[model samples]
Target: MFQELKPIQVETLLETNKNETPINYYQCDSYVLRRDTTNSCYAIYVVKALIEILYQLRNVLFHGELVPNKGAQNVYKEAYLILKMILDKIR
Candidate 1:
């Protein structure tokens, strides 16, 4: 459940793209993900969130919604770092 996640984890999930310029999908719908504790691990929840964010980014890029820029790069970097954290926890 989300309650089991560390404060920083929840905070990161909630606020990672709050300042992304040109706006990414995550900034509008961070609450779209839910705590599906009945059938998944905490890592899966995080991974699912990551996937959702990435999918949104992919859609934006694929559709030419926003020109790639430094802010977009930062979003990618943040994703990679979050992914690394999840991998570290699982390993």
Candidate 2:
């Protein structure tokens, strides 16, 4: 599930350029996850980005912006899987 969501999370991160306004910027007041371009921990960054994506997903749903569609289902599913993965790890 992590592998499946990694690309999507990375793509989201790429699309959200740090120089521009990020999703829920007014509420979060910053990028979901700060990416250190100089850092060598690429895997760590990906994981953090996944978490951030999940956070944004929650905001989208809460704001009633999530359309009931296939794409929305996929995004929600990915976020769910990632959350489950994190929970498993911490336990």
Leading candidate by lDDT: 2
| Candidate 2 lDDT tens digits, 27-55 | 13443544445534345666776688889
Q: In model 2, which runs have C-alpha deviations exceeding 4 angstroms?
A: 1-39
Off by over 4 Å in 1: 1-40, 77-91
Specify the poorest-scoring 10-residue window by lDDT in model 1: 18-27
- Give the local distance difference test score of model 1: 0.62
Error of 1 at 76 (Å): 2.6
Could you list the CA RMSD of all candidates, in the order they appear? 14.5, 15.0
Q: Write the per-residue lDDT of candidate 1 for residues 1-91, one digit (tens) a residue.
A: 7767656544333433333353332424536333323453344557677778877877887899989899998987787787678679989
